[model samples]
Target chain A: MAQLTMVQALNKAIADEMERDSSVFCLGEDISDKDGGFGGAFAVTRGLYEKFGEERVLNTPISEILISGAAIGAAMVGSRPIADLQYGDFIFCMMDQLCNQAAKMCYMSGGQVKVPMVLRAPVGATQRGAQHAQSLEGFFTRVPGLKVICPATPYDAVGLLKTAIRDDNPVIVFEHKKLYGGKRVEAGAIAPVGEVPDKEYTIDFGKAEIKREGTDITIVANLLMMYRAMEAASHLEKEGISCEVIDPRTLVPFDFDTVIKSVKKTGRLMIVHEDTYSNGWGAEISAYVAEHAIYYLDAPIVRVTTYDTPIPFSPVLEDYVIPSTERIIESVRQLMDS
Target chain B: MEAKMLLEMYEQMDLIRTYEETLYYLFLEGIMPGSIHQSHGQEACAVGMLYGLRKTDYMASTHRPAGHDIAKGVSVKDMMCEMFGKEDGCCKGRGGAMHTGDITVGAIPANAIVGGNIPISTGIGLSLKMQKRDDVVVCFFGDGASNEGAFHEGLNGAAIWKLPVIFVCENNLYGASTSIKNTLNIEDIALRADSYGMPGEVVDGNDVLAVYAAAQRAITRARKGEGPTLLELKTYRIAGHSRSDGCAYRDDVEEAEWFARDPIELLKNKILKEKIADEQILADIHEKNEQIVNEAVDYAIEAKEPSVDDVLLNVYWEGD
Candidate 1:
């Protein structure tokens, strides 16, 4: 096993899957070129076209709608397509094709057709602005037929992407822009590290990983927010707060069982996310936990999220809007005190 | 040239008409579950086009897809069962009238979204071409769809790739009551094909023979690596956009005009006028068709409904 960044893990998964299945082909903007824009905006698909030919690792035009529609159609007719959107925010242009057509086709056809496609979208606030920085998991999770996965570690990124490619249904894998250990325009950025398996393997979805062990409180988070929650847990450990951190890798078939069991032990729950507070993914988790694990809870669940406003381009406003480590710490301390 | 091929065309037309009429009555009786976009007047376009296609060749149809589905060989029983929301229906009762379709029959489920099937058909064509298959895709859309950006994008893409696709526009004048004349700048929807550098042809859609002849030419061209064609069938819909409306938007004069030249009646007269079949043979064909339809209804009525547990099934394949 070797320690790899999330970007390296994604490249490995795609490279392995390409070698494993001849049907798998990747098409997106700037996914093919070597130094210019290999892999993607995060370099996840770098060195694929070099190993495979241009035919397999295709560089498409800047048409998101056509790219998504073509991927859906290609998948329907029998070609496993892994389409990449530069940012998750751009996925709005192709939502009809992804949501209505790809998601509903097999079900609408009564199990007659299968859309075996993987859509890779990079999400998270990196101080880019309102257009680029958005945690798009909330939008996609609402769609019924789509499988939404947001992997937090290198191991999970490799395994989950492999699983998504092999899946018959269309799967949307959202990678956090800040979490990818790569160069950013700004001075400070998130660069979480994890080890990845050298051998080929895939992890099952709907499973939660307990990042840190504790008994006093449970901190639920995903993607970039997961790292923030982990940092918050570390700080609380010094004060004897002993908070548990749970990361749900996949949102669609969420691993609620693991979280519920952890909540039972801890007797307190708190959710942290970068998405807007109103109708964010944290609300769903909070509601579910409140309904099922109410008797086990010691205090009301607290949610620390970005303010209900569009992501601003200014660094100061953006920092204030998004949930920071300080905010997570405050929320956890409040829950524990209560 | 052959007599059986001509008879097959007529049979398919009759089947479409009878099936639509049956669905109409079922809806009127309050037995059917969903709304329908019937293809009462455009049977010739479906029967004529599909009659010439192989089972391997694919067809992507529009909202008014009952005719195309039946003509392309979707079983009547499954279609009726689907309308009844039974599990045994073609789409396990998930898709209703507007989306009625069967992939095994070489028909992707009929898309209810206007012009949505254009790019999808192009994709099917791409797959066929990539695999080096002789199969061609016939994408059936409405006149309203010709004005859609999807139509332009899909057609341009298909033409540039020289993919084997037949962009069939069943231009029955209106798209949900808004006349094509109001939406389109050009008089003939087929003319848009010239912009894509593909051959565009207009045919009397009500005339099955004319439509069949045009389809044959396009299919032959596509089978070779000659690229795509846009065939605009000048036809009309006798029914409203769906089951609820009375189609009052259509002029009575134009309605009477199209009815007089009914594709079913036109084909019947051609058969009788040319002495292709006698009264006895016609009677026998009608009786056999009635029996087939009756048996289909019986099978559909007796079909099972999917359990609540199965709702979660088929969302993703769990590997056999």
Candidate 2:
């Protein structure tokens, strides 16, 4: 086992996949290392351009629409493509291609073609204001043909990216900006160091990882919120309240059984995410738990999510809007008391 | 182009026109299921552009897909079945009239969104280049699609990557009854290609030989790895954009002007004057094309609708 950052792990996964399959090439803006171009906006594609050459590690113009559409076309015609957008917010620019063409090509073609493409979009709020920062997994999760994954750890990032690259369908993998321990570090960025196995392994979709064990309540979270949930759990342990944490690796093929099992044991559940509170991913989790595991819940299911407002530039307002550990702790303590 | 190739283009154009006319007649009789964006007068554009293409070369079509689908060799029976929402459709009843296509013949599902298929064509070109394949992709769209943001994005990408794609914009004068004059600022949509660093050409879309010659030049340039070319064919759809359109936005004077230069008629006169084919031969070709359309209609009408269980399938592919 070797310790690696999330970005490093992702780079390794893409490099390995490209090496294993030549058809697996990357296309995005500023993804190349030549001509002083950044190896992607966050350095996730660093060294890949040098290693795989320009053809595989491609750098396109500022065109998310073309990038997504081209990737779908390539996938439809027997080539695998992994397209990346500089930010998750730009996903809207290519929504038609991502949602309509890439997502529906196989279904519309009657399974005659498979769009084996992965769209790597870095999500989550940082200092960047309304346009750049957004937890966009919720938007894409609603799209049926896409496999949406939110990886919170380096191990999960590496394995899941590998799986997404090889998967014979369109996969949207949302990597949190804070978890990317690259050279361009953001303020309040938590360094995620985890051991990645030396051999090739892939984690199946719809599987949830229990980050921590508990008996009183279950805290379901993903991406940056998963770290907050873990922090809240640790602080609650000092107060003699145990909170089990569940990280759903993927959203569409959600691991309801894992959350349901944990809820069945703990008899309480709390869902948290950085997406807006209204119609957020947390709401879906809450609805699912209510529908299937209502009897197991000792109290009503609660959701701790970002406020229904665009992310602001000021740190205070941003922190206040996004769900903090204090908010998660308060929500969990109140649920337990009830 | 050879005489045989020119004749093949004529037959393709005739087939597309007959298919569209049949669809229009069916719509008028209230027998068709969905609205159609018929490409009647613009037959030569699709036929000339696609006639020389290999079956494996890709084509990305728009809402007006009949002409491109016909020229691309899409199974007319399956296309008709798709329009009828039958079980054995090329799209298996999922994609209807506007989204008709068959991947077996290298037609990606026709994108309904305006300018949506441009980027997809660029991606196919990228794939072909990566796979070291000699195939080039031809993306068909209306004049208005040239104004979409995707049009700029896709063309810029194609130019930068030097992908093997020929963007064939059938500038049919109108976008859903809104004239191109109101939507575009440039004289020709081909001029907009200059901004993307690609050669742009405007061909007389009603002339099969002219359209075919232009397409052959662009396709040859693309296959030679020279890069993408924008071929804006100056054509017009003889019918309305969709089923409900009454041609109110268009005047009869304009209609008469275009009808006088109809592509099928242009080819028929040329064939007769040059003695390339006798009037009887041309008449027989028209009769054969009508029969093909009729047979497809019958086959599609006889096909069954998909079962409910199939609705849940193909959302995601299942594999190890």
Candidate 3:
């Protein structure tokens, strides 16, 4: 086992997959060393260009449509491509390619072709204004054919990404900027360093991991929110309020069963996410729990999400807008009181 | 081209023409479901560009894709079944007229979104280059597609990487109801290739041999790893943009002029005048294709509707 950050784990995962499968290749803007070695927006692909050579690690122009469409096309013809976007917000530029083409190719083609590709995007509120900081899981989770994955820790990052690379369908890996612990540090970044196993291992989608075991309440979160939720659980433990924290590794093939089971034990549920309030992924979980495990609930389900507005540049306003551990604790206290 | 090759090209063009004419009537009779964007006048463009391509070479098509799909070697029966929304269709009834294709024959399912297939073709080309394969990809779109951002991005990527992709623009002078003259400021869509540093050519879309010769040059260049070519085939669609269009937007004089230069008739006259084949041989080819199309129609009419239990299938590939 070796201690690694999320970015290092992701780089290792890509390198390992490329080493194993010749069909696998990387393509994005500034991904190669030829483009001053930025190694993608977060330096996750830093040494890949040198290790794999220019043919495998391609540097594309600032054309999101071409990157996405070409990835879909390459995937259609037996190439497993890992396409990267600088920020998750840029995915809007290639909506037709992702939502229309890659998502629907298999069904539209009547199972004639499969787009075995991965799109990696960094998402989080890092004080970069509205266009840069957006939690895109909500938007992509609503898309049917595409699988959405958000890995919070280094271990899950390697395992989930490896599995996504092997899957026969298109998957979007939404890595939070704050969680990608590397040189480019942000204000609220957690910089979690975890030990990744030396042996090859893959994490299946639709499987939830319980970060902390408790009984008073179930806290469901992912990516940056997962770390924040863990912090809240530790804080709540001092006040005699035991909290169970769950990280849903994959959003589309959501591990609802695990969440429901957790809710059953705690008899209370509080969902947290950085995405906006209205129609967030938390809303879906709330509804699902209300439908299946309502009788087990001691209190009404609560959602702690960012306010319904674009992410602002100001640090104070950004913290106020997005969910905080204090908000989670207060929400948990209210649910406990009720 | 040999006499056999010329006759085969004529036969394929006629098959597309006859299939489209048959579908038009079936649609008129209310027997066919959904709408269609027929390629009635641009038969030579599809046949000429795709005639000699190996089954392994990829072809990406746009909304008006029946001619491209058929010419790319998707069986008439499969296409006919797709038009009828039957289970035996190439796309298993999921794709209607605009989205029919057979991937086994290197025809990716036709994209219904205008200019959607342009960038996708580049990806296929990239895959071929990565695999060290000499196979090429031919992407077909209308004149209006040249103005789309996908066209610019796709063509530029192909040029920079020298990917073997042939971007074919069938400039039928209109996009749905709008004329290219009103939409584009330039006279020749091929000139747009200069922006990407690729060779661009214009062909007489109504002349089968002329289109064939241009395609030969472009395909040869691609096979030699010389990069992408943008070929603008000046042609006109004999039918309306879709099922409901009465074509009131078209000018009668221009329509009559293009209609007289029918690609099939041009090929027929060329075949007879050049002594490539007698009139009787050309007539027999048409009759044989008509019979084949008729058999396909009968097969499609008898094909079963897709099972509801399987409706949820293929949404995600479960296994082999």
Scored by lDDT, the top model is: 3
lDDT of 3 at B260: 96
Q: Per-residue alpha-carbon lDDT of model 2 for A132-169, expressed as tens digits? A: 87997788778889899988888998889988998999
DockQ of each: 0.56, 0.77, 0.86
Error of 1 at B83 (Å): 1.8
Query: Tens digit of lDDT per residue, candidate 3, span A1-338?
Result: 99999999999999999999999999999898765778888999999988899988999999999999999999999899999999999999999999999989999888999999999999999999999999979998888789999999999999999999999999999999998887899987898899999999999999999999999999999888988899899999999999999999899899999999999899999999988888999999999999999999999999999999999988899989999989988899999999
The 10-residue segment of model 2 chain A with minimum total lDDT is A104-113
Candidate 1 residue lDDT tens string, B197-268: 999999999999899899999999999989999999999888888888787788889899998999988988
Candidate 3 clashes between residue pairs 3 or more apart in a chain or in different chains = none
Expressed as tens digits, the lDDT of each residue in B94-130 for candidate 3 is 9899899999998989998888999999999999999
Q: lDDT tens string, model 2, B1-320?
A: 46677677778888888888888888889877878888889999898898868988989999889889989999888888888889888889888888888877888788899999998899899989998888999999988888899899889889988999999999988888798779888898999888989999999999989988899899999999999999999987888888788789998898899889999999888887888888888778889988988999999889898999778778887542
Model 1, position B81, has a per-residue lDDT of 88
Lowest summed lDDT window (length 10), candidate 1 chain B: B311-320
How many clashes (backbone N, Cα, C below 3 Å) per candidate? 2, 1, 0
List TM-scores for all candidates, in order. 0.94, 0.98, 0.99
What does the lDDT read for residue B305 in candidate 1?
A: 80
The C-alpha stretches of model 3 lying farther than 4 A from their native spots are none
Error of 1 at A29 (Å): 2.8
